[model samples]
Target: MLRHFLTLLVLPGLVVNSSSSRSSSEEEKEHDDGSREKESNGHHSNGHGVPWGYKDQTAWTFNFTDCSGKSQSPIDINTRRAIYDPTLPPISLEGYDLTDDSALTLWNNGHTLELILPNTMRIVTGFDHEFLAAQLHFHWGTPEVPGSEHTIDNVHFPAEIHVVHYNSKYANISEAASQSDGLVVLGGFIQIGLHENENYEKILAVITDVSIEESNTEIPGFNVRHLLPNKLDRFYRYNGSLTTPPCYQTVNWTIFNDTITVSRKQLKALENTLKAGQEEHLNKNFRAPQLLYGRHVLASFMASSTIKNPGLGRMGERNQSTEQSEGLSRGDILAIAFGVLFGVSLLCFLLYTYQQHRKYTSITKDPRQNVIYKPAMKAEA
Candidate 1:
């Protein structure tokens, strides 16, 4: 009985080291009501290229056919439900490192800041067909709200970076955008890190140059590969359409499982720097997560059965303790290890104490059972 009591006490300590599981928020309560369907290219309601904003998305279905497609992009990736594809190869990039010999064009297309890349850079390896890197852009929100387009297990991150590419066989991006496997976009979530990133700074440094809509500027070239997560092997892949309209359903999406991090200061700059209209700050430019409609979300690596939402607090804000959540640093794992060791040591001490108490109780009641008496017979006298 004493051992049982000690065991119960020790169990709680072991549980203390366990990581916290993500709670399902109201976002999870949202279900696919089968309203997301197909559109005929969305020219009637809004008119092609007229203009749309994130504030209104229900109107997208009325204008574009593919916008209401069953396999739309930016779907909530339920990590536990993702299917593992062992055959999926590690994403390989070619000619991503750019020297500042020639400045790259940076465009403020009214929605987001875009950095145009040379076609020489490409996703040469990974899929059945090669893809040429076209341009990369970001989707961001204000400090109060996280503006990432794609979400993980219904949990939103501070921002998301998308590197867009087009199928190489096509003459241009337009020709490829119509095919089933025409475009491949690499997406990585952004979270706060311990320090500012020099790689990301290259872009943010010149953000003010083109603050207005329909503006363009040239920024010094830098290694574009550093913007993405280092672990290219782990990713979530699926066939989905573009988040923006005319929502083309021809993209092969590869969302990195491991997120990249920038400092809190850099994050704030991203939200406040760019402008969409004359004075309106360009934030929350991302569309809401669309329904999956039974589309399979594939994984390049085997995903954990459990889904944990660390780093993010309520309303998808970063918690101070885990602000630098770039896939658990060495310090975090070590802390967990030390916590488990301490719990085990305490359990051992409790077990030993319980045994000593039992011995004392038995001896106190029946002293003869444990105590050997020396006979006091003075036979020698």
Candidate 2:
């Protein structure tokens, strides 16, 4: 009958809705993967068939121990909850102004686009010792999904660039990567806008040459400073690990508050680029942010205002790092100066009143003049 047919259709819809809710509820479980036992016991080739990608991070071989580590990278930076510490100084780049073309090379690591720099280029300050620049890479998503590894206030940016470095105190990157505070990574957010960042274009121009995995090419070396934001003082600092495999918890992360603008054309080039051993475009090359787990995110500069959740495409309004990053603002300085001046004036007034009262008491208590003035005159005669 017609009624029976309609009931069948309604039952299918009800079942689909129930399944969808179950799926969403499963995802809401804080991203905790309970299938570790099954994943570990399953025999996959040592490195050949290791299923490593953005879709399933448990398949990564190096992350067996750190998959559930307390300290992880690409965390959500809630600026409102960050502590403003003036002691965090502005990062100083030592040899980033590379005029020598021989110093730079571009390569397509299976995961992201990478640019290798010489050890001469290093982060001179912002740590107990210097951190030598090893390499820099980017993570991005498609036009629809923002792929930045780290998010601000749970809002994802179009992309993110990580400048990886090794601590100078260590012999090499291998040794530094295992120790605490051994690595320093400078993170900068990228946003899609109308204008192109000519500085970033230097590396993007060679996207075709390194289109495949393990492919690399030479590029005319430019100033590495161009890759970073103009302001480096205002940043969120925290202790975290690398996002990829071997998630070592040794990095000192400094993610800038400001963002660099890139054109849609450039973003397309990044998104459409091919990965190694894949015909499809390498899109959504980012990891979801992990829980904070009570980690403290320190800020170099005091935030003037709170950024609303999902504040994207508003680079101009973001905090800038400058000379005033660690010091009090002009208004704060004036307020403190006024308070000190008022306190000093009040103390001076109290001292003057006490002196006047003492003088009056001394004059009023001159009883010798009243009783002894005449006796003293007779004695003198």
**Top lDDT prediction, candidate number:** 1
lDDT of 2 by residue, 249-355 (tens): 44577899988889999998999875745675677877778787766677777675322222222111224442124235456679999999999999999999999
Where in model 2 is the C-alpha error above 4 Å? 1-51, 58-63, 305-381
Count backbone clashes in candidate 2: 1
| Model 1 Cα lDDT, one tens digit per residue, 273-320 | 777778988889788898877666666665444223332221232234
Per-residue error (Å), model 1, residue 368: 43
Count of backbone clashes for each model? 6, 1
lDDT of 1: 0.67
Best by TM-score: 1
Clashing pairs in 2: 234-321
